[model samples]
Each structure stands twice: as C-alpha cells, then as structure tokens.
Target: MRKAWALLALLGWLCGLAPAIAQVSLPADLTQRELVIGTRVAPPFSMKNAEGAWEGISIDLWRHLAERLGVRYRFEERDTVQALLDAVTTGQVDAAAAALTVTAARRQVMDFTQPFFATGLGVAVGRGGATAWLPVLRTFLSFGFLQGVLTLLGIALLVGTLIWLFERKHHEAYGGPPLRGFIAGAWWSAVAMTQAGAAQDGPRTLPGRILAVIWMVASVVTIAVFIAGITSALTTQRLQGVVRNVGDLRSIRVGAVSGSSTVDFLNAQTVGFESYGLPAQGLRALKAGRIDAFVYDRPLLAWTIQQDFPELEVLPITLDSQNYAIALPQDHPMRVALDVTLLDTLRSEWWTRTRLRYLGNDAAN
Candidate 1:
C-alpha cells in the first residue's frame, strides 16, 4: 500500500512537471530566432526617417516587444498596407507592424495582437481659395443655368406668338412678311418684358396692348425667380466644401490610400474613389485639385495635417471606427505570446509615453 501511494504521487508530480518543461522549452530557441517584420510608411505609426532607419510608435512598440521576448527582428519595408498584410498572411514575414486595422475579413486570414489604437475614417480637403469672380461666372454658364434660360426663352416665344396674332392685322410692326412679322412682334414683346421700352408705335388693338401690359407685369416676377436661382446655384458651388458623410461622397472626387480600410469602406458604400500608394500622394493630389477630398484613417490624417500640411483641414466627422493591431499569420507560434505582451504594453505607461511622443497632443483614447 505504501509503494502504491508513492507511485500515484510520483505520477501526479511528473504530470505537472511535464507542462512546465514544455513551457520552458518552447521559448528556449527564441533568442536564436530572427523574425522578419513587415511594415510600411504610415506616419505616427511607422515610417522610415531621413537616416533610412525605421521610427515611429509601431516601430518602438515592436522593438520593445522583441527585447522583452529575447527575440531578434529585421524589418522589411512594404510599399503599401496591403503588401504588409499579405507578407504576414503568406508567411513571407513572421509579423506585420503598422497601422493595420483589425476587421472580421482580415481576422479570417490572420491573427491580430491586442488592439493598440482606435481610429476611424476622415476626410481631408484643401483650404478655401480666394473667392474669385471667375467661379461665379462659371456657375452662371453651367448646364443648369443654360437649362433655365432655355425654359424662359420658350415662354417668351409662346407669349410673343400670342402678341403677333393680336396685333398683325392693324399694327404695322406686325404687318411684314409672315416670318419677319413674327420676328418683329417677338422683339417688341422682349423689349417690353425687359422694361426696355420699344421705340416703335403702340399696338392699335386694345387686346394687344392689354396683353403687353400683363406680360410686363409677369416679367418682373419671372426675372426675379431667374436671378434667385442663379444666385443660389453660385453659392452652392462655392460653399459646398468637402464631404461630411458617405452620402456626400458621390458628387466629389475622392482619394484613398491603396490597400487601406478607407478603400474597403468606400467600396462597401459604393462610393467611387481613386487609390494612391501613400497618404502623401493623396494629399498632393488634393492640393493640386486632382482630387476634391482624401479619405483615410482619421488619426493619421490629423497627424499629417498637424505635422506637414497645416493648410489642409480634416472634417469633424468620423466613419467605420476600427482598432489597429499587429498582424501575424494564422496560428503563428508567436501570436499568443505577442498578444499577451501587447495587451500588457497597451495598459502600461510606456505605451502612453510612446503615443504622446509621436502623436503629440492628438493621441487617441
């Protein structure tokens, strides 16, 4: 009985020890393992400095995590966010550290570490330019303006034909050849309606003169309506500004960074947008008036506007709020370890300090 009890106790002890041994052995080779980290230039998150060295919040975060894990890493630059995600998904790189947003679609292909940042879509637009007369003039000649003018002309022609019928028998001004008589009466009607009194004699018939007086009165109201419409159109074109929401995106030329969540959002909304490889490219396009607005991550656009493009403005609206996380291949060995470290780091003072250092006063909560 004593031997059997001792054997049972030993078995339990070995069972517990086996897990410890396995846990301890797992990271033993981590010190010798070199991880390939993929990244892109996404300012305030990850970027390559003028010295050709990586720097930013994401870079520092990865460096600290690697040091804590006793693992070595080398960063490979991907041209765009899509490229970075693809590298990790395909196992071409062990991990990706950038402003990669965590979404259900992406979660299916790869695993993400605990979220380190939260942000949403933003719209950036060029600063208001000098209010010029040329724009107003252009508005006046717009298609809508021409359509209104055509409608007014048609009304004037119909009224003129009525006046010609009433005055043609007795008034010399309407007694010429058929077409010429009609043209003369039309000119007289136009002059009277515009309050630009005609030099020709008055119609002999009372009905003709009565019709002229009525047309002159109606002209005042019609002219006022036309003027109001033109003014309203001009004001609308000048002050329309950037898109405040997805619905407003339809009428404007929009730009998005290639492979970003912005593109996905725009596509899902069926809002056509032009894609650029970098935010800088999109900003340049906006400045050059090639694109009316740029849509991207709100925090990134805010950081960029605060840092490099003060002339531009970010709309106060936000869309498709998302959390950004470090991406790793599905079921990667380091995924859980990284997530543990990342969660702890996010709750630490270091994360706050790092965010403040790069994001300035605009750090997201």
Candidate 2:
C-alpha cells in the first residue's frame, strides 16, 4: 500500500509537468545563441516612453514567449518596414514583430502566425470637409439633367411627324382648316433643352403634347447614362471633391518618413507621397504648415502625438490597420518556436499592464 501511494504521487506530478515541459521550446538553428528580434518603434504599442523602453503589443508578447521558454532575447530595433523585412529575410533576426498585414505577397517571403487581429483600410478626412463634399457629389452625379435633353428630342420627332401628316392631309382633300393652332413637338424639346422661356409663338396643339411625351422618355435615358458615367469617374478618381482615402492621396501631397513603412504603404497603394527622412522633420513641417497630413501606422502615430507633438489630434480611426505578427523566413526552424511563445505572451497579465501603462486611455480596451 505504501509503494502504491508513492507511485501514484509520482505519476500525478509527471502528468502536471508534461505540458509545462512540452511548452518549453528552443530555436532550431541558433543553438546557444540568444533569439534575435526585429521591432519597429511605434507608440501605444512598441516604443520608448516615460517609464522605460518598451515594445508594441506584439513585441511585449514576444518577450513573454522568450521568458516562458527560458531563452534570452536581444532586440534589433529598425526604423523602416523594409529594414525589418530585410532582417527576417536575411536571417539577421530570428523574427520580426510589427503590425504587419498578412498579405498574400508577404506570405510568399515569410511564414506568418495565425492572424491576431483583423483590420481594414480607412480614410481620415478633414473632419468637416468629408461631410460638406458628400452632398455636392450626390448632386453632381444624380439623374437630374435628363429632363431637358429628352424634352428637346421628343419635340423634334413630333414636329417632323406633324409636318409630314399635314402635308398628306393637305394634298388629299379640303382646303386645310388653317392647320388649327397645333402645338409643335419640336418646339417643346427646344425649350426644355435650353431652358428657354416659352415664346408667344410656341407649340399650342395636341401634336405638341405628343412631342413632349417622346422627349421625356429620351431625356430620362440620357440622364441615367450621364449619371452612371459621372459615378464611375468619381469612383476611379475617388474624388467627389477632396482627398479621402490613400487611394485619393494623389490628389494631395502626403508626408511620410523617407525610408519607413509609411513610404512602403503609399508605394503599395500607389499614392502620390513625399518622404521626409526623419520623423521629427515631418512633424516639424506639419507644425510649420508645409504639409497637409502625415501617413504612418496608428501606434507610432499615437506615440508621436504623445512623445513629440501634443497639440495635434489623431482622429480615432487608424488609416489602414494590419495584424501584428512575429515573422520568419519560410524555412526558418525557429518559426514554430517563435509563434508558440508568441501565443503564450499574448495571454499574459504583463501584456495587459504594459499596454495600460503606455496607452493609458488610448489603448484599446
């Protein structure tokens, strides 16, 4: 009975450790080398702040994973999106943690963890301007212009018919009863198309009414086509009036870090963008009133607002959000090790406190 009890206790302890032991992971290639991490500084996520140098949501998560696996980590800070990608691709770093979108193109180069966040593109318009332009665009593209064109066409047809019919009647029999004050269809069409005030000699008979009907039908179809064309043009230009999305960024001069993610994003979107090499330089230009707006990731933008420029307001919406993932080259043996630890950190309590500390109220609840 004493041996049986001892054996049961040993089995229980082993069962509990099975998962914890299983949870520990080591880099396949690095062996004794510390894990190399590539991170971009963005605020409200990853950055150096009042308390201490910290990382973004994903970075913090990666830290947690390393601690859990009993592996030491050395962070390689990068300033641009391209630099970060180069680190991961060249095996300079075991992984990169940034708010990178899991795009199909990116997948061809690196392996991505399961998407942690789902986000889409958004536009930050000059608050008041977007509202003001909406109505103007609706009017400009609506079917209101069709009536005049149709009226003109209807009248022409009516007049031709009347002229032909009258001649036939005249030749057939009686001295035509002074082609009784009949309205001409062509007259109504001319008036409608030109918005001309009716003259005293205007069409005044039944024939004119028939012309009006024909013009109305033609006008309706014409206007419909015109409106559709206008809408298509607006869609292509994305400019009902002013710039709205990155797609419309061409309409305005956009500011960005010369060699940063913002630049890559614009190039990807095909936005007309100008690069200002340093972040402070771009903000300085904004303060000096040189540029309209700066384009970058939301967390970094928020960090900039808090650490550098406080007066400027960042509208709540992120221009175009993407999921933050730890990336590695396709054949990287550390891929599974990185993602597993990454998942563990995402659920850690320190993760929560770190966010609340930097983001305070701005952090997503």
Candidate 3:
C-alpha cells in the first residue's frame, strides 16, 4: 500500500513538470546566436521615434519576451510588411515582430505565434465638406423623393376630376371641352396647393365651393408635410455625408493600402479600389477629396487618425475580422517559448498599460 501511494504521487509530479519543461526547451542556438527579428513601420505596432530608436506595441512585447527567455536579439527593419514577412519565411530573420496578421496563405509558408491583438478592417473618411453635395444630390434622386412626387400627382388628378364634375357647366374657368375642363381644374388644384388666393377662382356651384374650402385647408397640411420632408432629407444628408456603411463603398472612389488585407477584402468583394503605399498617403488623398473613402485595419486607422490625421474620422464600421500575431520561420524552434512568454505578457497588467499608452481608450480589452 505504501509503495502504490508513492508511485501515484510521483506520476502527478511528473505530469505537472511536463509543461514547464516543454516551455524552457528553446533550442540551444536560439540563446547563443543573436536572433534576427524583422519589423516594418506600422504605427502603434512598429515605428521609430524622433531620436531614431525603434518602439511600439509589437516591439515592447518582443522585448518583454526576450527578457523572459534570456535570448539576445537584433531588429532588422524592412520597408514593407511583405518584405518583413518574406524575411521570416526565408529564415533571413528568425521572427517577424510587427503587426503581422495571420492568414492561411502566410501560414502555409511560415508559422505564427498565437495572436496578440484582434481587430478588423475599417474605413476612414474626411470629417466634413468636399462630398457634402453628393448627399444632397442623392436625396433628390432617392426613391422616396420620386414616390412623394407620384403621390402628389395622383392626389391632384383625383381632386381635379371632382372639381371638374361639379363646376364645368357653371364656371367658364372650368367650362370647356372635356379634356380642357380637366386640365383647367387640375392646374387650379396644383396652384391652390401652393397659394391660398387660388381659392378665389374656385368653382361657382355650392358643392364645388364646399369641396374647394375643404381642399384649401387640406392643402395647407399637405404643403407643410412636403416642406418638412425636404428639410429633413437635406439635414440628414448633410449630417451623414455620402457613405454610411460598407455597401456605400461600391459606388464611391475607394482607396486602400497596397498589399494589405484590406486590398484582399476589397478584391474579394469585387470592389474597385485605388491602392496607396501607406495609410497616411491614403488619408491625405481622402482629405484632399481625391478618394471618397480609405479602408484599412481598424486599430491602425484609429492610431493614425489620432496621431497625425485629426481632420479625418474613422467610420464606426468593421470588416474582415483579423488577428495580429508574430510571424516566424516554419516550425521555428523558439515558437513554443515565444508563445508562452507572449501569452503571459499579454495577460499581465503591464500589457494593459502598454496598450492604453498607445491606443488610448480605443485599446481592445
């Protein structure tokens, strides 16, 4: 009985030790050789300060991981995200430490650490003006406007037919050939809808006078309603601008970052978009009215807008959900170690402060 109890205790101890052992099993060379980490200038993820020192969310996270793992590493900056990712895939760099998004195509070529941040594609548009007239034009051409016109014409026809039946024989204004009488009555009704003095030329028959009085009062209400609808439409159009959601992007001049996940999404949806080299360039185009909308990563857009492009606003729209993770060479020996430290660092209080420092209240919890 004593031997069996000791054996059971030993089994439990070994089970507990397995995870710790696996976590520290980083290859011997990973610690000895200075690891090459690739990065690109993607604001809040990777960027150089005025002093020329590199710093950002991904950079901080990597530094934390390196400190914990006791590994020496050096950063190799690349001009574009694709170049950074390519460096990782080719083992030109041991890992990519930028805002690398994990996709199936990338995964097929290089491994990725568990995602550190979650975000989606967003649209950035100029705050106001430039496209203001577009909304007004759309309002006038809208189905509601056409429907209102049709309903008004129908009412005029009905009222004119009634007035002609009562007054065609008694009043010269309405007395004529059948078609002429109808036209005269219809013109009177339309005029009365806009002017109260039009009632003076109303039909002479008692029944005709009664119908005229009722229509005059009703016309007041109709005119009020019509003016209110037009006013409301113009106000709404001016306030909401031209684009309200993703569906509105189809007809507008759209811009996107070249070689980004946003471009992939726009292509998949069959949306024609002009590609810009960077988010700042795309935003500048939008501000200058060259592009109606600029689409890119939500967090990155928020960061850029807050930092350099205050004249712009990011629409409260999200598309193409994505996860940002560290890119690494295929089956990298340090991947497991990196993931362990990454998850721990992400779950710590320091990570919260780091994110808040860069993203303000926009930081994802």
Q: Clashes in candidate 2: how many?
A: 12
Candidate 1 on 1-365: residue-level lDDT in tens?
99999999999999999756433222555567788999988888898889989999889999998876678889999997888888988999988998899988899999998888888898888877532233466676678888989888887887788888888888888887889778977787777767776526557788888877788889889999898888787776655444546887876789998888888889999999999988989998888888888999988898888788877888777878889889989987787678767777788889899988987787756
lDDT of each: 0.82, 0.60, 0.86
**How well is each residue in 213-277 modelled by candidate 3, as lDDT tens digits?**
88888988987899899999899777766766667789899999887778878888888999988
lDDT of 1 at 123: 86
* Among all candidates shown, the one with the greatest TM-score: 3
Clashing pairs in 1: none
Candidate 1 structure, TM-score to reference:
0.64
- lDDT tens readout by residue for model 2, 1-365: 99999999999999999888557566555657777888776554556656867656766666666666667778888886778887877878877776665666677888877565444432222323333355356445546535544554565555544543543333322123434323332343445434456423333345544554565566567657756765675564343334445554665556787655456577777887667765667767655556656666566565666677764544444455566566787887766766666566557677667767766775553
The local lDDT score (0 to 100) that residue 176 gets in candidate 1 is 76
Residue 346 lDDT in model 1?
85
